[model samples]
Target: MPKPRGRGTSAEPRRTVKASSGSARARRQGKAGERAGAKAGPPAALRDRQERAPASSRARPRKAKAATSLAETAVVKRPAAPEKRAAAERPAAPKGRPPRARAGDQASAAPPKRRPRNAKAKSGADDAELSPPRPPELDWDDTPSESAEEVLAQRWAARGEELFQQLEGHGAALHEYRADLKEGRFVWIAPNGRVSAEASARLLCSWSCATSVLVMAWADPLVSGAEIERIDGMPAEQDGVDEQGAWQIAMRAADACNAAYLYRVSSPQAWYFLALDGLTFSPKRTSFHPGAPVGLVLRAIGEVREAIASRAEPADVVRDRISALSDSLFHQARYAYRDTDWVARLDRTGSCLSHLAKRIPRAGFSAIAAGQRIDEWLERELALELINALSLIEDEWSLFG
Candidate 1:
């Protein structure tokens, strides 16, 4: 029992050895525990417990409901796929059978029957026909007639005038109605048309009472252009004859012409009668004998023959007077004389007279001849005086000296 100091140290060593052995034994036991747990089964850890259960042969059953989210505990139910119904329950026919034929099966099937071709074509054509055509559009920049309608109207109007000119040139009658007053007849010269009786009577009336020579001159062949103008201008003087006679009418017409002549000197055609009337005597161009009775006679009646009776007459006067008288005789002989020899002589004389007349002024001669028409008695008397005077002058010139 009483303890020693050295013994205390020895005991400490032993205690240290013992403590080491105990720590070794403890580590071994721990390793044995880990090996036992591995051999036995999964550990009692959270992950191991959860994974240990058989997924398909779980002991508990899930509730019949729709699953909401994967992370959440909630569950949900899913809808199933739709199924087909029996054919009897459907309204439309089933797919196996062909579709029922149309109600108008005969019309739709077989060969389509054609109507009469003409009738079908006509109906189609009628349907296709549209409204009447409109007028053509005009190109203002390029077309010749900017406004076609206006140009057409102008052309239509001008066509008539052009046709008229063409007809006038070729189809118009060359010789139309010509009145020969001396012959008392109207002659119409046309290729085919007949002259009307009314026109004939009118022409005859115009030509009536004219001299035979005048008729031959105007009606024989082609009438003179101036003569035609005269005929046209001549108005019918016979307007229900009054008691005074034709002389009064003639005087009145003559007076009117005389009055109108003053204003219309430029238009000689208007005053043609002035030269024919004796009231206005033109001055003689050639000088005759002042004292000679022949000159006096010539001045009064414009008779060339009377002028030739004078002695010491101017050469021009004598020549002119002789030439005029010779011309008158020749003109008379042309119609009166049947002999060829006489015709030649008349022609020669007429040529000489023509030359003289050209040189001399004819106004005086025309006036004297015109004066005779003032009175019928005067005309006859002057004509007789002219013949006597001419005869005397001719006899005196030829027989004397």
Candidate 2:
């Protein structure tokens, strides 16, 4: 038992075995770590990420709950509707006279006047010859004095309402006629049936032309330049009396009508009541995606990518620039979650962004393969995605604060 060399020297054998086993385990662990490092690449610092890093990499779970709590507290609240603002604080009356009738009141209003006998008789007449009929000759004692402006306004509105009604009537008649034809019931057709339809159609066309001119006369100059050009350069009909001059006169008349309407009705009231209803009302539902804005920028970047992908050699500079822009947008949208301290929420959004990036090119390429322009489809897809995203944001705004 005197310090045996090969045998146990008290705890010597146990210690030796333990040391050997520990070294073997340490070697195995080092090899495993090396392999893992090779597979995973180098560890990335969260703060050291480039401005345009892939969305997923950038969107990480917050390490501390304090950051999230602060974010929840930091939400910017939408301003409350004012308790009361002076008429001055209120937005200016939509640039014109108020409407003569509210939208809902149209059905109950007095019947509009029919086409003037004078207009029917003249067919085409000079403005001087087509002077409007004088307001019913009234005794000063019996009637309140009306300014020329008021008189003209009243007459124009009456005519506009009449025209709108006539258009509606004609549309209904056309539908009826088509139905009858479909049913094979051509019996007992009146001689004047077709004539009447033709006349109404002509009148409707004329009214539309006149209304367009009238609308432009009062149109806000802020309307797009293209619309202005379309108005100014409208094509002239051969038989219509000095078509250019007639349009000009009609435009001026329209301004007067618009002034009267603006003075009477609110913007929302006018849009709902007069103009849109005449055009027909078929409500369509539109939707926008939550991640669309970033999608568009990504698609545009993809175009750059495809360009880079093409050619005999890669254009690294161009590719890098485009990639940077795409990445920047992706990063911006992803980083927004961080501002809100929604690390968990952002993780999902980042995944969506990455998915969108991948899908854009796939969609674009698919379109190209299907005999469509890839760029065209890519841009269009991007637009749709943006619309979807905006819609989501709007919904969220409503849902949250």
Candidate 3:
């Protein structure tokens, strides 16, 4: 400011020289202090602190220094005891995190502590928490399999078998008699005319008595008065006995007898008979005669006797008989009655028999049970009439002397 300083001149040259000398002296003193410190070693307080420190803490610098030396020498050194103890004492890192490694101690580090295998929760407990509960087991027993009707039928069949065994004991004689009658070898002459042998008359009388017993046992109590009168008034010569009239007469007598027999049979027995009839008997077109009813009665008696002798269940047998009776009646009615009033009566009787034949065992014994037995006197009188008729025959030549 006093006078502009010249470009190459200084106002304090001597001062600048003095500052240079001072800086050189300061540098020389610092060097001498460093050399003295090297000879004397560290201060007493610092050395004492280093000696008192834990081995784990004290080995840190030594390890660093060794690492530097190894780098310089291109060789590796084993970790010191202090470094190993420090690594062993360190806590294991938490799961999902890596342990922090020292700057130059990566190789000296201990293996990461494995989580204790037994320390984890039990596998069963974990599964219980994650899965749904199990279902209970089922019991298949105690379940009903059959319908009520089926159970009833089975019981009825059992009962029927028991009854059949009881009835079989009385059938042997009847079957033998029926076989004898079927031969049709006997002949008859008018009463007071040329007579057959006494033995033949006795045999014929016996057959007539057997046939009457069966017919009386089987006769329906509901027989129409008109039908009874017609039968009672019939002429011995059969003047009106054409195919149609013969059918009507035979069917009327047979159906009445069949109805009575069915009434006497048990429900189970009846049902069994019906099933048998369905299997064995079907409708057929055929001729009818005065002797047709007798033939049918004999056939039925033979079967009944056979069944009784064999101790066979009667349900099937009875059912078949009823069906046969009904079917026979039907064929006769169709052949004999066309659209006449007798057709209706025949149809009704046939329907009654058909119902009996088709009945199941749902009602037990009450379904087909018979009412009271026929009056004893009436039965006796009918038996007497049959015997008398057999003794006289139209041609009384067959009568015993």
Candidate 4:
């Protein structure tokens, strides 16, 4: 507690100690405070009171507050706040109207206000600047930030992001991770549930490609109407297809394509234009289809004579013929045949095609290059004889199918 100063009985006003006027701090501090008060403007309570005061009193503008290191040393006079003004200072009401009540009178009649929690109360004029502070709980404008998990759950969790599903029988799986909320990006988790940029990207791309292939099978001519039913029967989706599952999808697509293609050139009746469709020296259409041995051999000879006839690459043609005979599908079809003559014909045709495949040049032969540019060596009479022989053998197999 501070010691009380005694007052004289003569009713003299109280006197206080003063700092030396010449002190450097007193001069600096007075100027600093004067500048601060000028920049800050009047406090809210003082502004409200000023607004209600008579215009005449407001006309007499108050001087800026004085500055000093000690608040006590600062002395300045202000026009009385409207709430503190006497009744004489107010403007009179118009005729027939009762005198208007002042804000101070109304406040005096109201209940004393409650103080905010956590804010300490103090006595004195410090209350003029910042008293009756608001509690944080009552401030409705502020928003709270959520954690990463909470953010994902709120925005991106229709189907939970951290999903898991096994891919076929492979050890690899499609899994997930929490989202990156700041950038609004979702990372592709690796097959093993680890974060790896390269592996994850590769997995993502492979899955995308295989899914596209499977979807494209619906549009491919290779897939028959029956195959479309199988596609429809597939499950809606798992968590997400992983690398292994994508491979399996791609394999099914391949099977559909291969199965459809088998009938493309299966028999003599389904003959694809071997080379004669539009490749003759004089391009002309003929209604008559080529019949076995003689007619097929004549078309083959015409193809060899032409410089621009599309020839099947000998290497590819031979491999296909030999693989067909030894492959499972062909073996099953062959087992169905009880006629020894048909079986013997198949064996004999396979041997003939295999012999022709071996005759193609091993070195300096490129299917792509040969197709793009004319093959000078293949124009020879020997290559012509081989091409005709292939046609004759293919004609025989066409009847077998």
- Work out candidate 1's RMSD over C-alphas: 28.3
Q: Which candidate, 1 or 3, would have the higher TM-score against the true structure?
A: 1
After TM-score superposition, the amount by which residue 287's alpha carbon in candidate 3 deviates from its true location, in angstroms, is 15
lDDT of 2 by residue, 15-104 (tens): 433344444544554445445434555423221222233455223233222342232233223234565445447566665787466677
- Can you write out model 3's per-residue Cα lDDT over 271-335, one digit (the tens) per residue? 10111111101113122122223333333334433433444333444446556656655764564
Q: Per-residue lDDT for 1-401 in model 4, tens only? A: 55555675445556787754434554554565556555656544333433354455232323322223233233235456677686657676799987766899877787778886535544345575666867676656557667544543343222222222211123224433222212222233444444322111000111222112123323323222322223444442333455445444433433433321111112211111000011111213211111123232233323332322244334333333333333322332254232334455445544554565455544444745565333334444545666577566656545533
User: How many residue pairs clash in model 4?
Assistant: 1
| Local accuracy by lDDT, each model | 0.35, 0.36, 0.36, 0.36
- Name the regions of candidate 4 deviating beyond 4 angstroms: 1-341, 361-383, 397-401
Q: Weakest 10 consecutive residues, lDDT, candidate 2?
A: 198-207
Name the top TM-score candidate: 4
Cα lDDT over the full model 2: 0.36
**Candidate 4 clashes between residue pairs 3 or more apart in a chain or in different chains:** 30-67
In model 2, which regions exceed 4 Å deviation? 1-144, 172-401
lDDT of the structure predicted as candidate 4 = 0.36
Q: Write the per-residue lDDT of candidate 1 for residues 1-401, one digit (tens) a residue.
A: 64445645654344343444433544454455445545656444422433453465323223211111121121112333344444445478679997777779956788868788799878878876864667999767764645644554354336436534543554443434323322223333343433321111111111111110112112322223312222344354333333223323223333333321110011100111111212111222111111112222222224354343433234344445445445444643443343434455445545644554443333356746755233212233433544464465444434322
Ranking by TM-score: 4, 1, 3, 2
Residue 131 lDDT, candidate 3, scale 0-100: 91
Model 1 clashing residue pairs (backbone): 65-76, 65-77, 66-75, 66-76, 66-77, 67-75, 67-76, 181-207, 276-370
- TM-score for each of the candidates: 0.18, 0.16, 0.17, 0.22
